[model samples]
Target: MFKFNETSPRKCWLIGHRGAMGHAPENTLASFICGQKLGADMLECDIHLSKDKKCVVMHDESVERTTNGHGQIRNLTSSKIKKLDAGSWYSKKYVGERALLLEELLDWIKEQKSCLGRALGLAIEIKNEPIRYLDIEKVAIEIVKKKKMESRIIFISFDHGVVKRAKSLEPNIPTGILYREPLADPFKRAKELGADAIFPRRHLITKSLVQNAHKHKLFVVAWTVNEVKEMKKIFTIGTDAIATNFPDRLNRVLSNAVKR
Candidate 1:
């Protein structure tokens, strides 16, 4: 449902990595709000299933890194996870910010889009590795459809099975594959997984790689690009999208690039 702008000079998307993680706590509402205010074309967030089977916004399988709590997210219920202080670790000024439910985040996005008079895209990365959540793909798809947000979001995963499963469940939904290593033929692999896009780590992207992906009709979105120089390099390489921890910085880069 998320379409790339063909007419733009760069023909690249500026996505907020973990909702402007450089400005606010990752995966929190504050960070997402900051990204939206900074004019991010899209917001990228990670998802995990709680012990109670609710979809929760978190990048890690455990809360140790991002929150004041310690434990596997799958071991905790939504109520317990919501009670933890998700922002203090990043800054005391954001002392009371809590992790958001996927539904809550979607609602916030919807509200922001209405007020901003523009559509905001979302990249939802499902965290499934080592230990897979039962039916997470199905549940997440159901939630997105219920929110009527199927058109505004795309599913991405490091797991090929997850990407394939998501596409199988909903043929119309767009899916992307996330990989860090150099693949022999990324386009072929992505096509095998039924992915419309491929998200490679910044270092793995090359001009030939982008060209090949584009040749196969697959969008190439580089992940977690933060520095100005690195952003410029990726832009010059012609990636279809740049995912960054600082959406404001990416916006400035895009603006300057367009002017030049």
Candidate 2:
């Protein structure tokens, strides 16, 4: 059976957020390669639909924040968006690194699978909020199925409907709901939506949330936690996975946990 909850032989899964943004430019291939090198069990990337309806791997609706270009991803064609210098903002060494397609990332992952001896689960956060991409879930899932990588993917989105639609289309694919707000009952909400995982804001992760989520057979993957002190707290709370910008730091913490 496919399992996203279990991180056996280790206390928790170390997921690289935006491909270890702390080490390399977020969502760039260098970042993903760095994440895998640093021992991430999964690598996270954001997705948005370009003007021509191509799936682009990025965290923002606009390219201004992370790239040399300035425009909304939905407004630009994939060819236009893909040509931007996505790495220069981070460092001169990465100046020529261009933005990538979801397909490109999948291909790289496939190439790395044999070398690493493990396929990293991709925590694909569908960027549908603040600028909804029509039919994005279908577009995204279709690529995963085409690559034969549905078994190694997890669809997460702040928009509940996105995950719901994705699950409705492919029941075997694992889905997770992301929320920063306090919900009356998240586990119930996830169960109703057919999501087996919950990606809650780190602060909202209480002991009861983790325990009850597991009680309901749902898993919890906390988001973007960077500080070591906070990491230890989340570890104490027992999240299934802790997504972070520094997978190396998280790996160190997990190693120390084993030592103690």
Candidate 3:
């Protein structure tokens, strides 16, 4: 099995989607902290470049929905972007939450590492599509390399071109091609891009697809798996990892189902 992080790969890996979004606020620093506390082995987050080209941890192309700001994320400078309250929309308890810089999130994960005694992996997904934020992959590479997280960070993207760009910069770092549908020749596409992993939307992940990806020596990962039934199905199909909003729940369910 591919070892991600210094963490033992023995346990079924738990990857928190947007960092334990079910318990705290999605994609906020607080949510990530909550995820770590809830026994998440790895944290998954989306990356989008600020107008000034700094990588920030967020999933949306527009800021109007997630933050108090009103514009496309590509249109705002990091300074202006930082000032918006990112949490109040979720609840009053999270009133002052602000967008987190990728560097800050990395530092937080590193700190958690010291206590967990396991290298926590980060599934960093590139959010720029339709040719916006042309330099996002470059900025993401610089951050991952600088932090010495090249081994543990799995770079994934829906934009296959972005994944290709990342692989070009550093082939050693694992890259996953994220897809919403089961392509007719998924293995061929992954091989062409030099992708180490194939991440498909949860429902689309089947035993045949998993087997097909493995034929090309690619690891399989699935996203947004939050239910015990779905989680059980994915586990039986044998994915390398799963991105989930409810890591703790899945962990317990998985443990029970397997034990029974």
Write model 1 residue lDDT over 110-227, tens digit each, in one string. 7665112458878999989866898898999998899998878899999889999999998777899999888888899999998999999999999999888888998889998999
**Model 3: per-residue Cα lDDT over 1-260, one tens digit each:** 13632222333577889999988778899899888777677889988887788887878887887888888777788888888999998889999999988988888776675123577778899986854778688889999889887877889999889899999999888888998976888889988998888888998888888777777788787888998889888887777677899988877765665566
Q: Output the better candidate (1/3) by TM-score.
A: 1
lDDT of 1: 0.87
Model 2 bad stretches (over 4 Å): 113-117
Indicate which candidate wins on TM-score. 2
Count of clashes in candidate 1: 0
- The local distance difference test score of model 3 is 0.80
Residue 185 accuracy (lDDT) in model 2? 91
lDDT of each: 0.87, 0.88, 0.80
Off by over 4 Å in 3: 1-11, 114-117, 257-260
Q: Identify the runs in model 1 with alpha carbons over 4 angstroms from their true place.
A: 1-10, 114-117
**RMSD, one per candidate, in order:** 1.8, 1.7, 2.4
* Best candidate (score: lDDT): 2
TM-scores, all models, native as reference: 0.95, 0.96, 0.92
